[model samples]
Target chain A: MTDVKALAQERQQMFVNVYRGKIPTRIPINSILSLEACIEYAGANQAEVLWDMTKAEPIFEKVNTDFPADTPAGGTRRYPSFYQILGSRPFVMSSEGVMQHPNVQGMEPEDYDDFIAAPYDTMIEKIYPRLYTELDTDPNTKALILAKAMRAHGDEFALLAQIGARMRAKFGFASIPSSATTAPFDFLADFLRSFTGICSDIRRYPDKVIAACEALTPILIKKGKLPVPSKIGVTSIPLHMGPYLRTKDFEKFYWPSLKKQVEVLTEMGINVSLFVEHDFMRFLDHLSELPENTILRFEYGDPKLVSEKLGSKFIISGFYPVMLLHTGTKEQCIDKAKELIDILAPGGRYIFNTDKGAMDMHGNITENLKAVIEFVREYGKYDNPDEPYDLSKDPMPPAEKIVAEIEANLNSKYYQTWEQYRANHPELEGRPQEVIAKKIKKLEDDMFNFIINLGS
Target chain B: MDRLLLLTQAISDLDEEKVFQILDELIAENPSDEEVQEIVAACQRGMIIVGELFDSDDYYVADLIFAGELMSKAVEVLKPIICSRKKDTIGTIVLGTVKGDLHDIGKNIFKGMAETEGFEVHDLGIDVEPDVFVAKVKQIEPQIVAMSAVLTIALNSMKNTVDALKKAGLREKVKIIIGGNPVTEDSCKRIGADAFTTIAGEGVDICKKWIVNSIA
Candidate 1:
């Protein structure tokens, strides 16, 4: 058996090297498979495992032992108990046991003005109830269900974390502490307005859509930043709706807020990894405007074009079609890896991954997937892995603009601000006031994140 | 430009207000059934331009969606006249988003465009099981069976649907076309679909060609 400890250390170092804009010994494989895929692959009943997440321990153990990748085995994608307790309309488990997020509109088209006026507050008051049926009840019942839902979420997360940690330790998977956030516009389009609704509102109420995104910018930033910031661990933001918009509409509605969130998170030393969905080829120039070393995993785009355009300024991964893994022979799959590595791995800032994450058991042929990963490991080495690269050439947006925006929007009407606290407790002066204010702020921030996370 | 040409341009532009204004004016003029048919055809031609622009990347999926909305709104203004005309239906299509997939955006877009283009679309709605699709086909005996799915797992469901149709002896009766995020050339062949598309406009165009070929 390989020295699991040394392998884990080496993988971590390689990822750190890449995050800092340096080439590693080989292209790091960060392939992600969905929870359904793991459970089904482990020969467990997916529905049963989803209901009792502890059943997934053996599944992850088997998968981590068998799968060849640099990244660790991920826990459950969404805590089923969390959504199940809340009776979440937008995200519900399908009959097949896989969680499906169908399009749902929590906010109506006419509610745009209200949503824009006070984004998070409106989400709590109007949208949350519509999305989570349990939360739509009277005050006492709503509070009780909300608490129960939170408890369920906590229990599931704790159990999964334990399983995830055990797998990493036993199997020597790289410890990449990451957080997830949605793009501001995607948060709006996904939960508040449905995909169809947002698309319609972009034409019908363009200004309001833009305003809602702007209002969401600060909250999304708070949601995106890691608890303890790291240079290597990324906050993955799955971008949606950009490719569906015209350049003019993208610029107006999507880009500004997203660009702000990325810049702010980047400035905070939190690496931003974007799962760029669909064809974002036209917006390549716009993406180039983001901070240096932002990891972009393209779902659909010409890899050559992406490499030629943004290779020097950013870390590029993805564009290996997962469908090929499902249908192609092992040789064909390896040939694709070679093609993408030749184009993207030439520069130091490339990671080998699939265009999109595997969704279910049908997403990949197991032998083909294993062979492709092994082939990438052998074939993806660099001749000069440690060559010096300068990221300062491509400048990120100034921090002052982002800080100002965040500060302006940080205090919400739904939560008590420090100023409000200061006004309320006039007797407590100086240090006492400051200490209480800090604790209050932390609690408020946590509550805000909890609310916003429910939407995404 | 003539009023018909103006209407075409407005629809193509997705200028909903202008499309409605011109439509309202035509309704006031009490246009004949043939003239109304000509107007509807004009609007569809404009929608074809929208599709072309979408293919060229000048427009987008959102534009296609808005164009569908624009087409429907224009049709609404012309509905009274359209009902009076009693035109021959070009074809019939049974459409749904397939089993275990609740996404209806793509399917709905195709249904709207196909309806405007004069196909009698029996929308079976989202998460439609194989038996539902089979039963719909048996009931309607439509010329086309369109299955849509955004999830990859739904691909198997689509295959199951095709197999179900074949088992029911309805496979040869209708041409199968699959649309959504997951369908590719390989998956289309795997699912035993006759055709596949990710774009609604393209899907409608394919259905139109299928009908035209069948009629010939």
Candidate 2:
């Protein structure tokens, strides 16, 4: 009989190999599907199956069967698969056992006021009660209930309980990846508050805003306790407040709160991983204060610049654009993968992945996965190639220079000439500038911050 | 000349040490409603700039969140004073995330923005049940009902909430508006909703237009 421990060890070895810039037998694929796709597959409407786990399970099982891979034998195991987990809402799915929502819903202050005015502790407080009341009665029912509830709405629940004992058994001590925490501002804007409200709040109630941040830390810390895998440290996705505010605003509202979270998480020995989603081309310096071995995930960020700035200090993942899977042909995907591998793989602290998940609309997933696998097989070997790649030698111009260029161009004679040229044409009157000079300037500043921080 | 511009720049800079100082100066100087409006407009411009920055990867999520917090603070300070004389009611809205979901970031943001856009919003927070949603509509007598949910599982909760409202004879009284990451136009229709938007900004616009068309 095959040795289970050996196989598990082998899988870990392969993962480490890829992480260490060595080619593995095959690239690992971790594909995530949302509940929408599962609903579509089940031929159900949104309402009929959302509340009932039993109703959504058949479709989930079918999808899993269609895309079969051996369930990991002994590490942290996620039961009911990702699909079942995502589909476990308390509301019933549509008659066809599929998920769908025709109207998007949002709340205002009045809505919250009305809710708080009412008796219930809101929906979050009712989880345990509902689960105990509605779940089936069987010896194994507790485990099933836990699994079903987690599958449905577990992101907020205690993490350890969500991952059943069977699943928890698969992990080794210190084997899981670290958790990443977002700056309070990013957490609220991206997850809690609306972008517009947050921007306005910064000016109106800075103290209240800071107080809110301080208040949330305990809640987040409490939530963080549920998911600390023994071997793998907690890593959070710190999606910085980008595309919403200026750098100075970031320095004030964002950094202070994030620095606090990082301090707490680091002090607890958890790893901080950041997904710098927007232009960090200039903001890397702010991140320099973070402890060493902090994991960095750069999306749409220049890899050359990231390596130059923070490469030696952190474990970096990603730079590949997920959109490439949908837009690029197989050959193009392969070429791009090779290019990334050539540039990012030479260093020991890189892992290959797209900047973000392959979104639902993305196509040619298999081809893209194949491209990544093929590139790793062909070029990821640790054996020194005839021509060693050196990232330090090819430095890009400072981000400030780029920003300056853009600022200069915004007021350049050509732009003025164009405005004058178009002024006579009534058809073009009141039209906004076609060239996004202001946007470029912002990008330049952000990038410059990122680059300058690389040296720090 | 550009009081609004100056205020907005100060807010964006987030000079905490100097924020209160500048705000004190502005309040003491007693800027006119027009001046306040201009500053509000500047803040709006800053939001658009921030949005563009986010879209173009010029700013990070943290920057947007920080700036948003600052902007919200500034607006709060001016809002009470700006509308002291006027009792303008654009419309009333009842909003909540459907039952079995605890995510409220999207809902809270929408609530704040809706208020800014001149709507009286009743925010129900997260995991609201269908019957409760209907009860709120009847009690509040809102002209519009907005629902939000971030999880796919809660999609049914949204539909059920609408269905319950329709059954309770309250659906015709309100324009049902839905917004969230998982929600789309098709989903809105399938769930028997009148409208849907992906972001809070669009939700405000949808609510505003819906009220206008209803009145028309």
Fraction of the reference Cα-Cα interface contacts (below 8 Å) that each candidate reproduces: 0.57, 0.26
lDDT of 2 at A208: 59
lDDT of 2 by residue, A148-202 (tens): 5543333322333333232323322113443323455654443234444565556
Off by over 4 Å in 2: A1-6, A29-456, B2-86
Best by lDDT: 1
Candidate 1 C-alpha lDDT tens digits along B1-216: 799999999988888778888988988988988898899999988988998888788998888888887878778878877887576789999999888888888889888988887899999987888999988898899999999998888899999999999999999999999999878998899899999998887898899999889778
The Cα error of candidate 2 at residue B103, in Å, is 3.0
- What would the DockQ be for model 1? 0.61
Q: Which residue pairs show collisions in model 1? A: none
lDDT by residue for model 1 (A154-225), tens? 677678778878877887777766778889999999978888778778877888888888878887887776
Top candidate when judged by TM-score against the true structure: 1
Candidate-wise lDDT, in order: 0.83, 0.55
Lowest lDDT sum, 10 consecutive residues, model 1 chain B, at: B80-89
